[model samples]
Target chain A: MSQLFQHLEPSDSHFEPDKDEVLNAIRWNADGLIPAIAQQYDSGEVLMMAWMNREALEKTLQSHRVCYWSRSRSTLWRKGESSGQVQKLKAMNLDCDGDTLLLQVDQEGPACHTGRRSCFYVRLEQNKAWVDQAPLIDPKTLYTNKP
Target chain B: MSQLFQHLEPSDSHFEPDKDEVLNAIRWNADGLIPAIAQQYDSGEVLMMAWMNREALEKTLQSHRVCYWSRSRSTLWRKGESSGQVQKLKAMNLDCDGDTLLLQVDQEGPACHTGRRSCFYVRLEQNKAWVDQAPLIDPKTLYTNKP
Candidate 1:
């Protein structure tokens, strides 16, 4: 049996996602969203967690730049749109149930809005949420508007 | 200036998270839920992503067994309760924004219900979701009940 689990169509080397397959592949939540996690391609370090809609997934797949849905703002959030910290999508994976997404990304800059390399800076150690890393750049410089 | 971000109370050597901090620290969504990602402590492989409520968080912190809120069943899901694959919590991190959670776990067995090592077996390569890893055990044997 071929190792290929689910193939859209024969593409010699390039990714050519079928539009219908893309939409039907995932099991979207009640709100038509799925939880997406960004992991560093080289380091395997999880950079951040966010939500994505079908449109965001399509945009990311097409442009190869990660985009997410800003639930609070009720709009599409292009990663690093204002801060220039764009993440280049290396690979994407869907969990078995298809309720989650894992994106291997080549992050341009710090992933956290707080200027940390990863958003997971608050380590639960010794009963305290210790700030594990210091800011790489001033957070003020990262965001243009209050997000 | 102290590097300590947010401290619950003093626990010299062990993690003693404050109950108040546990509940108040997180910015729960309108539905009072947060997205949680589980990663293997040693490999840094993201095993799975799930939802967590205040009660789930409290249970995980207190018991260190890693429980999730089952949105589908509308009940608490104890990791490996049905299957023998319990995850031991090594560490927990709250992102700077406190909206998401990262769980470093010592997974006892396959993290996926499909009996695969990780839920993220459906890799998007060449525009198709190829099953990178095969199931170590039969999935039918893993699930005792319809979940």
Candidate 2:
């Protein structure tokens, strides 16, 4: 137990080292959070990036589903609760300094609020023009209650 | 053209006034980027979050596919070009602040590196145990030949 404390810096009071020390071993920004990138486990398509405070990080590790700190609401949110496009966690990884996280998951439906499969549908054209593509699934079908 | 300069601030050099004005009109953080979430257009699964510099933001908007700044590499990256789980743009929206963006996309396949459909597959059970729900797809089926 004492050995675990050795690798941890004093500023890391929020993190409790465990077997998967690498996950808990990274340095977080002053906000006590790190940027986590969620991607498709098989296809390797990047879905989104969110901040994870220590609590959220632990919750993610404990729950296996990804939880993130919503900067807008300043609260912890479980991905896909309202949309039903839940991300089933497959693995979690940390970058070299432990500032970033990669989450691999199993997705059920569109992840973006716009009702598309992913949130990255937009792109820049050769002439620097903005264009929108066809939607795969209508958001109205998923969230009938909300607009 | 001078009228456009009226809204320009000293810090706006890195961003185009037209784009910045629009992005700022929508809502952005001090960093001049919005929190855009990426989801699987097909599965409706949430994938990851990435910061969009003005250039990347404009690129995504113009192209109708997702483009983001890779903080890790500090470079521009387009989805699906490497892994093949490309995200085709469907739609885009700005949050109340004009800083946050919501993108709707058509995801081709797995959006995660671990071969899962999404990035939030792991969840902690009530008993404080790590649980993995989904299985991974074979990489061979996803990539015919490495690109």
Candidate 3:
């Protein structure tokens, strides 16, 4: 494998470290959360970014689905639980300082609540933001009952 | 062009808007900064993530080079100014809610101060983070004058 491959193939040996040790390796901020960014696996388009607490990270490790710590809701937010725009985890990476996470995911549908394939739809051009891409689907059609 | 093409080709009509209006469209948080993620232009590998304030963002727009707000130093950190690891801006995009910015750049050298190709080098797998990459250059050699 190249020296820069971000994907980690499972270790050949049955070498499982202590779960706590694994979690402790991360340098969570004072708020006990880390910034986590999700990218579309094949296209490499960065879909969205959110925060992840230990529980959210653990859940993602177990379920192969992305979960984020919702600072606004003060709870764990599972990707696409209501909208069905789930993100299936292909790989998870910890940054060098352990303060950030990057997830390579197979996004089920539009990754943004606004129905864009990526949350980023506005291009910065001529000192302004230009709406370069239209929403793939209507935002109203995604959510059913959430207020 | 597909709806997912993140690369922003420069506009031809020269529709320039007020700089402050462009800046105000971004939802700066309480800290008056936005999370900026840089991705390798051709490879699609995310290089590094940093914070950018209005000045740093403005400087980048004017120079076509990447600059970041140094939270610790309290000044604009011109990337590669000392380390020679400059990032040439190729494209820039603002996220849906206008809270995040993504930069596609041609990285001249290792993006990490640690000399890795990217700041993200540890892959979370089999319940832990595995160092999946090696530093491309010696960190010590990159800085000769900086303390």
Candidate 4:
């Protein structure tokens, strides 16, 4: 992973950081995980937020695809591996605090398991109530006929 | 704080939640803080990310302004109170996992203390190096008088 991975090849803004060095800079939580926000590159829309461990981040950098640590399954979850809603990584950014991540990706299909374009379909209304904004796509249809 | 503050008052989308109920839903980290992502509502541009505790979240909801728990200062920090880079809260959302927050805000001026529109102005180049993509603003000018 020491080899340079050209994220923006053929461009003037080119620089390199060792893979291990980049990973070490992150201040992981007590759970050894960091929160990663996935945003649509072109639209600037926030698609979803997930958790990533060192292995997940390494895999994402290596594969050029979005990978997250599934706390439920305790496994490396590759985006769109099953649901066909893949996140093609465009670029990744670390916050100034180095405890969080921002992922700009070309997202395909819905980003939410509930079949919404974004996980933030619901918002707090004026009355302090939650209001559903985006339409939902049934997860059943999304997972139908697929193993 | 017990009374429902109309966030979207004089509108149709109005509802209310008890303060205790709202706080109880969040699963704060061991540090008694949760990660909060601030996104520009109209633009979908993520301006910055910060940490918020129960008090901060409550204050944001009650005041209709963004407040964060400053880890470095160990105090409740109100956005733009000093730098004039304020974040007006539009709405807030809790992820499905109840561990993180997505705050939709109307940001005024640069959100990054570094004077960038966002803290994520640096990108990982294909050469595996970090390249600055956004123009910098001097914090010295941003916080000139009255500390």
| Candidate topping TM-score | 3
DockQ of each: 0.29, 0.06, 0.31, 0.32
Native contacts matched by each model: 0.43, 0.01, 0.44, 0.39
The per-model lDDT (C-alpha) reads 0.77, 0.57, 0.77, 0.72
Kindly indicate the candidate among 1 and 3 with the higher TM-score: 3
Ranked by DockQ from best down, the candidates are: 4, 3, 1, 2
Write one digit per residue (lDDT tens) for candidate 3, span A1-147: 222221222222233334455467667877999999899889988888889999999899889989999887899999888788889999987776667889999998798877778876677864465666667787788887432
* Residue B39 accuracy (lDDT) in model 4: 95
Which model, 1 or 2, shows the larger DockQ? 1
Superposed by TM-score, candidate 1 places the C-alpha of residue B68 at a distance from the truth, in angstroms, of 1.3
Segments in model 4 whose C-alpha atoms lie over 4 Å from true places = A1-20, A144-147, B1-22, B145-147
lDDT of 2 at A57: 77
Quote the RMSD, in angstroms, for model 1. 6.3
* Candidate 1 lDDT over residue span A1-147, tens digit each: 111223422222234444356457677877899889999999989999999998898888888999999988989999988888889999888776677899999998799776768887667643455555667777778888423
Could you tell me which 10 consecutive residues in candidate 4 chain B have the lowest summed lDDT?
Answer: B1-10
* Candidate 2 regions with alpha-carbon error over 4 angstroms: A1-24, A144-147, B1-147
C-alpha lDDT of residue A140 in model 2: 64
In candidate 3, stretches whose alpha carbon ends up further than 4 angstroms from where it belongs are: A1-19, A145-147, B1-19, B145-147
What DockQ does candidate 2 score?
A: 0.06
**Candidate 1: where is the Cα deviation over 4 Å?**
A1-19, A125-127, A143-147, B1-19, B144-147
Q: Which ten residues in a row have the lowest lDDT in candidate 2 chain B?
A: B5-14
Residue-wise lDDT of candidate 4 within A61-102, one digit each (tens)?
Answer: 878899999988999899888888789998888765567789
